[model samples]
Target: GIQVEQSPPDLILQEGANSTLRCNFSDSVNNLQWFHQNPWGQLINLFYIPSGTKQNGRLSATTVATERYSLLYISSSQTTDSGVYFCAVGGATGTYKYIFGTGTRLKVLA
Candidate 1:
């Protein structure tokens, strides 16, 4: 079994601030993703960064599989971005499933 973790368990920011969140895993994995869980408890996949880096608008992510870690960055944060961010990892263990991190809670104030 693999263990996943998200740093800075909680975050509070102004509408325009910037932040970087991190995820650390204890074992090798075939897949890894970053997600945003909104107030309504909906999970939105942000990145499928099994490796390398990706950027979409003000959000970006990087996964270093060799190092067993990933990072999610947010620029000019917004209220819409206020939510719980999570890192989930999956492996080829005969079943398709994801082990999610505890999550990083972000609050973007107006």
Candidate 2:
């Protein structure tokens, strides 16, 4: 079993500001995914990087399996970015059981 935790439990930012969110896991995992829960409660898949860096638009993510941690970077954030970001990790057992991080709640002011 892997324990996942996210840093900066909460965040408030002005529009166009940049920020970083972190996710730490306690054990080794073969699957890792990042998701953004929009204000409307829809979950948007942001990344599926288990061990490398990836970028999509103004957002990017990096995962270092050796360090058991991952990072999400937001550049020039917008109000539309306000939401709860989650990191989910699944062990190598192929159990389809993924442990989700506590999540980082972000609010971008316009």
Candidate 3:
């Protein structure tokens, strides 16, 4: 079985600030995804980066398998970005299912 851990269980950022969220995995993974759960309880997919770097507007992510960790970067944060960020991983050796971490709750003050 694989294990996932997320850092900074809670985060508070002012609008226009920047922040980085981290996720660590216990084993190698073949699939990974970043999601944002809004206050309304909707899970929105942010990225599906398995082993590289990717950026979407004000958001970006990087995964280093050798270090067994991943990072999510948010630049010029906005009120809309206030939510919970989650990291999910899936590997060949495990149950072949994605396991989601506890998540990093972010609150952006306007």
lDDT, candidate 3, equals 0.95
lDDT digits (tens) for residues 1-110 of candidate 1 = 88998999999999999999999998888899999999999999999988999999999999999999999999999999999999999974664778999999999999
After aligning candidate 2 to the native by TM-score, how far in Å is the CA of 53 from where it should be? 0.4
Residue 9 miss distance in model 1 (angstroms)? 0.5
Error of 2 at 44 (Å): 0.5
Error of 2 at 63 (Å): 0.1
Which ranges in model 3 have alpha carbons more than 4 Å from their true place?
none
Model 2: which ten-residue window has the lowest total lDDT? 90-99
lDDT of each: 0.94, 0.95, 0.95
Candidate 2's C-alpha runs over 4 A off are none
Q: Which run of 10 residues does model 3 get worst, by summed lDDT?
A: 90-99
Which residue pairs in candidate 2 collide?
A: none
TM-score of each: 0.94, 0.97, 0.97
Report the C-alpha lDDT of model 2 over 24-89, residue by residue, as the tens digit: 999888999999999999999999999999999999999999999999999999999999999999
Candidate 3 lDDT tens digits, 16-81 = 999999999999998999999999999999999888899999999999988899999999999999
